[model samples]
Target chain A: MKEFETVTVFDLLIRYIKDGRIRLDRTRFEGLATYHDPCNYGRRAQKRFGHGFFEEPRWILDQCLENWVDLHPCRENQICCGGGGGALTSGYNEERIYYGRRKMEQIHASGARMMVVPCHSCHGQFNNIKAKYGLPDLSVKYLWELVADCLVWP
Target chain B: MTPENSLRISIENLERTRCAQWPHAQDNCLTCAMCSGACPVAGVDDFDPRKIVRLISMGMTDAAADSRWPWICTMCGKCEQICPMGIEIPDIIRRLRAMRARDKVPGILQDGLANALRTGNNLGLPKEDFVFILEDVAAEIAEEPGFEEFTVPIDKEGAALLTTIHNKLVNTHTDDLKHWWKIFHAAGEDWTVASDNWEGTSWGYFTGDDEAMRVMAGRIVENMRRLKIKTLLWPE
Candidate 1:
């Protein structure tokens, strides 16, 4: 276990950008964007892994998009997208959407048309709520999707 | 007193579960409701993080374990994060979830976890289909002007990075795989994906089965050893 290091995609993206292995096209993505902190990567990681990924995603977003905002109570205090803990596949559809009320409110309040999430669970939940809550204007993208879209080839 | 107004608590229930793993003891909670306030699903099915702690501390461990609240909770750790007493609400909830029999676990989660244990992926997608999807997706990416001749290097040894795919990306969202592949190609990073036991999400963690969680995670380590991969990019 000690021979190999386990890192997240965020770390890889950061390293690639820093080393100039990849350059981002900032103009690729438009519209007001905001981030949703996945609890495991944020609060839980802080307690268990000793270092939370609070700033990594934001730093990557900074390079990819020109306009982005932070969700209220981001990082440690961010609200759950309510699709976590395997709830997306837990067969609690109505209750899951109900649980995401606060998250819906947060996105509405942030006025961000695009919400970038780093976790699959959060991405699934945000997509579910965005449709269930009738927020067609809002679209969800994975952090990697943003990076991929903004990649400047050659 | 009416039966509805009065209830009995059993110390034996609490004592049995007292030694279970939780970072902090339930006795430390002050019923401050901070956890409840921070919890997004606090009121769902009459569940709240504070109530779970209170029930466990009051010798109502059975009541706490039997309720649907733990399952309802997303285990997002917001309650634990905001707890003034620093009680591990998520840990306690996970323990509560573990108390139930495996058959009693919610259906979708239970079935998915079982499939993951039996097969390499949660959806139990066959290796042939997995490879077929990868090659097909790569073909699509290659069709794009810049990514001609792109191919997925499966189970290649001595690669610098090994990435695990989220099952959904292969099952329903095959196109999404291109996003990361594009980056890897552009950066010229040496990465390979395992052709077997390559699941990214650990359903055992969600279902509160520690042993299963260990087995699932062990497969990843085994992959690293077999493939001689130096780094893992786990996006799950």
Candidate 2:
């Protein structure tokens, strides 16, 4: 609801941090992390609305994790996780996994143990990609999952 | 008439039919493979965005439309974004998808669209069932440490945030929502979920059915008006 001045969870969390309302425990997450930019929320929305949420997610990651790396060619240039445009439910399992090869390669190249994906589509896609590629070492976590895990209570 | 003459006649017919739909239809494309090169699904099922454009431009609309390539396209719009001629490849792909008969559409996508249109969610969830799931999830969350007072506000009029839920959260991955709920509780955000028409993702956008899309989107607007909520956090 940025158009109407409504804050996303990311924006609200940043506000909380700025206002000293919430402090995240950075040491809670020790594993290396990488972020995936969902196509709908990142590039397509950028082209349509003149603003993509490339930074907001990274900012959240920066606050919650001590060690994090960017997925290569990230933000607007990031490859699709191959589960968008209803492909998750479109009954094209093999093709969808095949399309995600580039993304899988990116994750493998990032060398991060965990992936931070904000979009539900991307979350599902990454989980399937991890399973399909047999990369049991890589795990996918939602942005909120990281934020909630790192939340420091007063 | 010879096969060559027949092909020319059909090409002319396709030109007359589809030219107005895309104003750039008449523009001469340089046959560059940029669009195909940028497309993620270009080589899948032997799908080539450049070839589709070429076929459509040459009045081979049937060849382009009949191929399974259009359905495989994710409609990412990267092809159009990278096109030198500014060709609307995704739009054209959407049109090809729309040309398929509703029943002939991919089963899951078609059923999801029909379910969203008929029951206000892709999973065909009833209002009571939705509320029950919300309350159930909320009660479970309440038992969590530091969230004993957590409750999912349903149909709370004038709430600052009216959020939509993806059907998968309610259907399969119910606990996935707890992450957001915990954050909302921690943030002290005033948000409510509508009991009816709470679906966020629009399968109409997926299927290219303009009417279904309009109805699905209109439900969100109608909910906002009815509840008098000014802000919406649609996370789909």
Candidate 3:
């Protein structure tokens, strides 16, 4: 940890997932959804802690619905939503969109109707991109919200 | 205090100074540099939090402030999740953003925040129209098969969960709120959507405006108090 002195991201996602308050459902809707493994989730939890850190929860999605969600540009190499780094606050309009455009293209290329974003900032940035870029049909959902929708186990 | 020990002491002090100063950190960053290491905007625009804190400790605000990393970082908070310290780096960056915002240094990206403040929602939709849009969408959801009883209530008081929606969800994706409302009805939860301070997602958080953020948060608290809600379920 570089800044604060507590609460690993690993612990948060794991505990949050296990909290039993979250649910997921495979049959709620039908469409090949893609997983936009957020930069935060891609780098923070997956690579920092080794594959073992992410195995369980990513597996949880598999358990809920196999092959329904796919990783676009894949994990460990996901695109930045371009809303971070105070960019949401930074005032870099064209560049911010330029960066977000890459991600928009990435998602568009994958053809996923919905994406599960774990981080709050990423969600904000990506949503901004979708609105301004006119890709309004794509839905970005919080990972916990999805988990809460389909909790079949304790 | 000896010369030999002085160097070590200074180094330790520097290390201590670099840790995030947020009182509410989740301890995800203490031993974890994962956020900085994994941050896409870090080296790309030289915005690494690890180095930022280190630089600050070294009296490097000039460099830190000049860094484009703040806008680059995305406030993902992924670093905290991986950090053993569990420090909420994203939160810290947000604070940094607010502080920088005070200086009037403009970036092209942050302009959307202004739109959010100007309009109740970022899409710049009028409030009256937004309300009408929400009702229309809720009615549509109700009309859908298996959603016959769904109602997207506005300003309805005394609901168990004080349901709030994002501004985007309200003005643009009214359907999403319908989904949440349907979910609430299905859960048998005593949730009612609040018309006043109904938006849970705060752009105030995005622009580094504590006063604005407080105002936004206070509105929700006030709404909850007035409505007598048991719990404030901020879906934001």
Look at candidate 1 and give me any clashing residue pairs: none
Candidate lDDT (C-alpha), each: 0.86, 0.81, 0.58
Candidate 1 vs. truth: CA RMSD? 2.4
Show where candidate 1 strays beyond 4 Å. Answer: B1-6, B10-17, B20-26
Q: Rank the candidates by DockQ, best first.
A: 1, 2, 3
Global CA lDDT computed for model 3 = 0.58
Error of 2 at A88 (Å): 1.1
Where does the lowest 10-residue lDDT sum fall in candidate 2 chain B? Answer: B5-14
**Runs off by more than 4 Å, candidate 3:** A1-64, A68-81, A84-114, A118-154, B1-37, B46-51, B77-92, B101-127
Categorize the docking of model 3.
incorrect
Tell me how far the alpha carbon of residue B162 in candidate 1 is from the true structure, in angstroms, after superposition.
0.6
Question: Each predicted complex: what DockQ?
Answer: 0.82, 0.55, 0.19
TM-score of chain A of each: 0.96, 0.91, 0.72
lDDT of 2 by residue, B1-236 (tens): 24575456543455555556774578557788898888888789998888888877876666666678887888777787788987888778888778788887885988888888889898999888899999999999998888999999999998988888989999989998897788778777788989999998888787879989889878988888899887877554
Q: Write the per-residue lDDT of candidate 3 for residues B191-227, one digit (tens) a residue.
A: 6766555665566656667676676666677777787
Task: Give the Å error, residue A115, model 3.
Answer: 3.3
DockQ score for model 1: 0.82
